[model samples]
Target: MKKLVLFLTVALMALPLKVKADEGMWFLMFIERLNHRDMQKMGLQLTAEEIYSINNNSLKDAIVQFDGGCTAEIISKEGLILTNHHCGYDKIAELSTPQDDILTNGFWAKSKAEERAPKNISVRFFVRMDDVTKRILGVTNPNMTEAEREKAIKAEIAKIEQENNEGGKYTVSVRPFFQGNEYYYFVYQDFEDVRLVGTPPNAIGKFGGDTDNWEWPRHTGDFSLFRVYTDKDGNPAPYSPDNIPMSPKHHLPVATSGIKEGDFSMILGYPGRTNRWMPAQGIEQNVSFAYPAWVEGSRLGMDVMKKYMDQNDEVRLNYASKYASVANYWKNRQGMIDALKAHKTVEKKTKEEKDFNKWANKKENKATYGKVIEDINAYYAATNEKSRHDNYLMTILRTSDMGALPYSLGSAFSQYMEASPEQRAEMKPYLVNGINESYATLALPLEQEMLAKQLQLYATKSTGFDIAPYVKEIGSKSNNDFTAYINNAFANSIFASEEKAMAFLENPNADVLNNDELFKLSSDLIRQYNTVPENVKTLQNDYQKSYRLLVDGLRKANPDKKYYPDANSTLRLTYGKVIDLPRGNKVNDAAENWYTTLQGTIAKHKAGDEEFEVPQRLIDLYNNKDFGTYADENGVLHVNFLTDHDITGGNSGSPVLNGKGELIGLAFDGNIEAMAGDVIYDPKLQRTINVDVRYILFIIDKYAGATNLIEEMTLVK
Candidate 1:
């Protein structure tokens, strides 16, 4: 296969002597061969084996993929887990009620018996990973079409996963890398009985909120604590009274010695996705078309949700996690758009493509490497409008529970209707419970407004493309106004209320669902969103082929440069040092600018302000200088710090380790100056914003007075 040849061609080349330490999300399996020496030179004290060892307890064993989204690390022998507060926001919100609004006031389990377990929360410990590129490539050839090649590779991957899973003892995943030129299978052990131990109040945990999210000199105490439980035999199990805290293979020791400029810092975690290898045309499409629609759609959803949220404490608790999620990405997309344009990223990628094209078109390379850029450019040109249209509809489904009911609940209802009586009996409880849960958190007025506004937004913005047919009909008849139509539909539809829905479940009917106006609207939107013209599918496939070749060609063209695969939620390591950026007229000085102290936090406080309000207790403590031992040598409690370590979305909550593999900080956010870091790493400007470990300790020990938690941890002074 051409892809196989491409993989081999790059593999056969000698490894580069050195690589920029701050730039890569590197695979653990290749660390010794590819990066160990460079890392040692950059002050990494751990051996490669100590960093990632399949044969022994190592740093990898302490890190976990929290809820399949963020990273968390083991901090105690009793399975104490430390992760970003935002990472645990959903579970915290789920466990919150108006009477006991722990999400707003914060929660702490003084004893293990008080720890609350939220349903469906789990953490995955990375066991090991191995490259299977050659095996995956062995099944297909150059003449095979993309579809055929994918089918063949998937079949082999299934076998590989089955073989490694050890009879369901582990969760095994085989993932494609470098645009499918390589493959690797990762093994993990999942613990389902995770329980929340403690969290600071919203005013503390989410101090700066959206206003300071991606900004530097941040003062957010973005950390939460949970504990993992296991069966008596130390095997993963569901929650039980008899279960005990897990004794993890390894746990990071907490470091309170403090940090300074140029101190070694490292992060090991799962970074979700990065399109660093994307072509110039793809970047242009995202910046100019796709992201703008996403930003607008997300903001509409946030506005609708926030209006209801602010009206009642219960509503706020119910929508807290959802609102935070939408708001975060809404800001991120806008920042990405600004950063991409400001950094001239598209122009840079375009220049790189031009250089690559020159090499690819050379006589010896033309037959195999030519046409890559042409196909990529043409594909984006054809799909730009479609991408914009898709995102607009997608945001509605993402934001409005009612907008997604047809797919989520309706699909379950369909399954119930089609099942045999025995199967229906087995599934009825789950189906009924699902409907009850959906309506419990959903405010009818809020859902109606969200769906109507999102549909209106979609109908108005997605011009030149066919809007969802039912939505279009309503919009046209009402001059793009969905208020009346949506109100009438909610008044009549069974899905709008639990009583109406349960009544329908007593005697489910296909005709009732088929003729429902709300159902029709949702069904139409889903259908249109999913259906792609065959010509467009062809273009997408061609784009995939060309993109793969482009990545491969770039590697071949630059054989002297080291290449690391883009992140796809797999465990990876990135290392660097404490770093600072020049701000306005100030020189880049870490001692003055690398970290934000609690004093700065109080300085920014605006009384009664939602995002900037400081808790009275915290303010009093700061005024009294009651920081105790959590303060630095200079007696200031640092809230957050900056590092040159590379990270992305899923890296949130990852442990920032000092040279001795001691936990010093928790990587939470990245500065806005390098929002384009997902596509291009800017060493001078891109920095990982982290919650200092001492701040976490102060919040737990002094602020919350959870000294039991302090006793559990192994603290290094």
Candidate 2:
């Protein structure tokens, strides 16, 4: 049984990652969330036999993957899909200029032809996912110990093919969780082109901005509308004049009712990773070092984005997604840090450890738990030095240092070089024009600020680097003087100088043959910079292995228990009833109200302040309808809902459906209280925020008067 548990831990925790902390009592919660057959009869859900089949083969081909790259819920008979406004903001924003702002004013086509093309946006539906886990893992023995287990798994994956992924819709991977406690597999389809649909201005889509990001009882209209399209016959294809909307048979109806507290809800979409079962030391790294650096870095980035965007409308428009993306994590990280601090996650783990030890000491329970807890800690401790600076810096290094410069150059340089004289003018209004636009000016400043913060944190917290003295030297040099100096330099950067910026921006046909200096330099730097340090990569890879080992162990021990894998950017389902859970006792939290209401919003309102004042647009929208769409018993507008659906990054556009499969709300963001929810998934803390669907309709119906959009939705109400 002991060995059984160890294997189970690794197996179960291995897949798209299972058991974010919220998965506690998951088996019970999922079972509780399960609608009885009679209930299913009314709700239009799978019957028992169907449910059996569905559960047996979650990877089967009932679901469709969006080919062009955005997550969408097919909500209409004619392929009306629902996704976040921000998700499609870019297409809409790009379509609009100073003369037309779809982002601010919004857009709705009066008819099908008028729906307007969204440049290159597309969607995909998965045909199938195979459980190659048994086969994938079959290369190794279940009986193999740690080192031997590692070697076999590597050999197996090596034989699985690395290069010719052309036929691989997406790599389907099987993963273990909790030291091999259980395992699961994921299926995905990737697309490079996606476009915008409709979006409310930032004032609505991100109403409260950074101030209100992760709070509950908050009213913010975070939903946007988008539709996935493809070629006429419904197969994935590049953009062309003759393309048509995707016609999906499994489309959701738009009129699903809103959920009240305790209504069971399910989220269906891709999720990223979570580390729910880390040891005390691992939690310490997250709480003290990692969380702080991330929060600080995000705040710094926000500072840079806000300063530049505030100054330039073009900058704001260009980096709309960038701001929201960073803010998303910013709000959550702060919330998570606060919640974990208040909850004393380490304390909980400590108590858990004590209990486990008690069981381990007992003759019967000893084998099952044994030194598993200790080993988890030991492995995690080894990563501490790397986790500090490397954790935060590495993420930015890949995204900014590596991906940014070259893209900026390419954007400014190569597109229109070969365009025929007339075609150059034609391409100007589209993607080519954006080349002259200096997003690097906007993005790099923000990253530079973030890097400054990270280096400081690294100097303050990280250890064992012989660069200890160099780290300190670098840290002190990066203070205000350094920032000002760098800003001055960046402000006058070659890209910042419009002489060059415009030269690249205006030339629709500036051709670069094999010898463009900037292009070659960029190419060389990208190669030189992106190479992860051998030591760091080795540590990260080993960490991943040990992490999987733990997961595999858990799966073997708890075969009877339902276990889900951690997310690895693949579709998954987490079912639970909507219920408000207590979060921070410090800032402001309540028992019955999981949602932050207008009352709470009002409490935090900065009446005289410019930065935090409620947007007049929101106030007018509120006044016009007086909580126009829906209201809680207290009569305050309810902006979001609280749920235990385990989620992460790719789960962004998921529709949070009730037991009856009604589209009550669109899951957009999570409350700040559970930012730590990603790593620790604390059920008592994390809550999924949703923009009430009815509010979206009311905005369109009452304010925007875009009746066409209103007409498109199949309203259940």
lDDT of each: 0.87, 0.54
lDDT of candidate 1 vs native? 0.87
Per-residue lDDT for 610-671 in model 1, tens only? 89999999999999999989888878888888899888889989999998999999999998
Candidate 1 ranges beyond 4 A from true positions: 1-18, 585-591
Q: What TM-score does each of the candidates earn?
A: 0.96, 0.73
Error of 1 at 4 (Å): 33
Q: What is the lDDT of candidate 2?
A: 0.54
Rate residue 132 of model 2 by lDDT. Answer: 43
Q: What number of clashing residue pairs does each candidate have, in the order they appear?
A: 0, 98
